[model samples]
Target chain A: MSEIINSPLLWKGAVVTLQLTLYSAVLALILAFFFGLLGSSRHGWARAIGRFYVEFFRGLPALVLMFWFFYSLPLVGIRFETMVAGVLALGLNYGAYGAEVVRGSINAVPTAQYEATVALNMLPRQRMWRVLLPQAVPLMLPPFGNLLIELLKATAIVSLITISDLMFRAQQLRASTGKGTEVFLVVLVMYFVMAQILQLLIRYLERRSERILGRRPRRRAATAIAGTTGTGSLSGVGGEGS
Target chain B: MPSSDTMSEVPTPEDPQGAPMDKTAADGALPHGSTPGIRFEKVVKRFGDNIVLRELNFTVAPGERVTLIGPSGSGKTTILRLLMTLEKLDDGVIWIGDRPLWHMPRGDGLAPANEKHLHEMRKQVGMVFQQFNLFPNMNVLRNLIEGPVRVLGLSKDEAVERARELLDMVGLVDKIDAHPTQLSGGQQQRVAIARALAMQPKVLLLDEVTSALDPELVVGVQDLLRDIARASDLTLLCVTHEMHFAKDISDRVLMFDKGQIVEEGPPEQIFGEPTEQRTRDFLQAILAT
Candidate 1:
């Protein structure tokens, strides 16, 4: 147990997981914003293109894309590092989903606001940044928070591609200590702890955004400073099927 | 339906009323700043199968207060939209002073005026919408400053100073930092009016600017509009259901029906003893009280 805690290999695994999640999520954000904007634009061709991207990438399982990016790219002379391949797969897969959230939030801006910009004679770009985007922020935040956590957890799958990660550390502990129960349990608890912390950060940011929107907070939520969140991160997945 | 009282011997070349019309309001327009803004020259507009303006013609002298009244869809709001360039006329031209606002010369010959021309023209025209479409996300001060800063290129200090003056003018100084949702309907319209005034337009369009207000709240807004119109050289074009407000503020009244002007004259001639049965019937239904 003491050796596992002191091992530089364990730290390397954890660091790699964190780096992969951070870099991939940032890349996904860029893709999501542009895809979202295109998905909601007036041009029929662009919207159709955005729609196709969203459906294809979102429908393709992340693990399959990971396998494809790692194994298939080498045959095409597109060989890349294991970490680069992992982040690319994660970014492409998650980007399609984020595009939907972006599109829906932007569409939700009232038409009257658009007309008002027309009355102002705003340039197309000015209308987008000044009017459309600000209205979109509060609507975009909640869904995006869920995506962030999903991206974080999905980093675990990169371990299959031989990229060291937290899951790799768990396997190392299980093999050496020969205590699958204790080692696996510690890793699971660590994941639960990380997810709960992220969930708390999202709620905090959501509260801050809501306050800026001038919405009055509801009873129980307004009072709590630190609250544990259920796994049902996006909408109702946390509730039991039973 | 040109009122008989408007008959003249000068023979102002009859605007080929029967000709094929497209953007008739696009020509013979009054010059902006140099002349009183806003002119219509036999303007004809159609929406698909419906003709909304039938060789319609009118002008507002600088600082003139004019009110447009008619049944719903009488094309009153359409006229304002045309001036604001929100809608392109099917026939005829509209001019602000000497600047041709409705059309830009294109290789296709004459295209609808492009955005840059429209922005320059719009700088001289401000409108308050019926819905009081204030930016819901911004405070009153930012709302007033956005167009002046971005569209007109006014400095922030200058914009805020002007915004402050306009807020005080609208009796909303206390609410300048408040979000629009916090204000009552009257207050919101007042802020919207200030937002429009911040542009310092030569022609101010008010499209039923107060009809959406609470009944009790209407008086405050009408008074604010009257005060603003009185102090500026704004050619006021108002579309409204408020009969008394129109009579009190207008230099002339244009009565429209089925999208054509049925009668127009000085307020007394049109409102007091309207010559057309359609005008009389419409007025009675509206001003029955």
Candidate 2:
């Protein structure tokens, strides 16, 4: 375990894995929003296109998609670096799931909010950006946190595409040093720690969003409690004297 | 997209004389000296097989306070929805102060209104919904200021000044920073009223504005509305089941049944001596409850 941790090759591989996860996560988020809005559009054709993309990506396995992008695309004069191909495949696959999360969260916003926007005579753009999206964002975070962790774990498959991520480095170490048990155990612990940190970060974001969206009553209650504290001291003195 | 063809060809007439006077003269269909606050001409609306409103024709004169009373599913609320352009018309036209609400001029003819036309027409109207529809994401102050600042193009300071005045009027000056969920139902409805009034709409549609409030809270909301009706010349078209409220505020009361007006007259006459049997029976049924 100590040798594996100290090895430069494994450290380089860890950095590569981190880069892949970050790039793919951002791409997945953008696709999720785009497809989610398209799926919820009033036009049937837009909705159909969004649905087709979601089903196609979700039905195909992520590992197969990685291979298809890396291997098959070159035949059609389309090629990407192995890392880029891995990110694209992972992003597209997980984004399909994220789109469903976005769509469901947006729909869960109360109909009264839409009606209120209409009654105010706000333009459609104003309604969606200012009212609907802000309310939907908090609801979207928990599911998105789940998908993000899943995406982090799914990055393990990218080793098959020769991207030199953590799993890829672990396999090389196992082959050369014949220390399969120690190398695999370290890799497992690293992935679990990464997932735990990601969860803490997502939970922090969820709380911040809830505060901004006025879903949390903590601020109001804190103020009320402060107000009562001053009066309660005065009342306590009076009661003890009586 | 059918309306796209007319978009380029239709001249965007300048509102040189301002919206109110310009609207009446722009459309030459209305007879001289007959500028209605709202006009529904042969308007038809349906939901699948159920006809909500059928060839509904009515006019509320400028500054008139008109109330609609009817049983459930009698299409009273549909009238308010149509006027707000919340629902599209299946057939016919509606005019607000002589400007067609659902159509615009296109080369000596009328076509369905495009987005710009609809936005322009909607500026003249505001609605108070039964649910009080205050934005939960915004504080009471922001709720009142948002429309004026964004749509009316008021400066933030100017909008804040007006919002404060409105909050005072609604007796909720203390709730400027309170979120909607923190307020009582009565207080929320008051804020909704102030929010609509902040728009400075020439016409205000009330869709059972008091129905969602508790019985004790209903009186407070009703009283605020009564104060508003007495204070301004704002045209009001309200759908309500409150017979006493209808009697108090309406200059004219319309009784609707099965998507048509069964009877309409001065509130005193309609409440005291109805001429139609259906109107009498409906009134009796309501009064009993």
TM-score of each: 0.81, 0.85
The 0-to-1 C-alpha lDDT of every candidate, in the order given, reads: 0.78, 0.82
Model 2 RMSD in Å is 9.8
Angstrom error at residue B130, model 2: 0.9
lDDT of 2 by residue, A56-172 (tens): 999999999999999999999999999899999999998899888888898999987888888788988888888888889878998999999999999999999898999999899
Deviation in Å, model 2, residue A224 alpha carbon = 16
lDDT of 2: 0.82
True contacts kept of each: 0.49, 0.59
Q: Which runs of model 2 end up more than 4 angstroms from their true locations?
A: A1-14, A43-45, A177-179, A218-242, B1-36
User: Evaluated with TM-score, which candidate comes out highest?
Assistant: 2
- Mark the 10 consecutive residues where model 2 chain B has the least summed lDDT: B23-32
The alpha-carbon deviation from the true structure for residue A20 of candidate 2, after best TM-score superposition, in angstroms, is 1.6
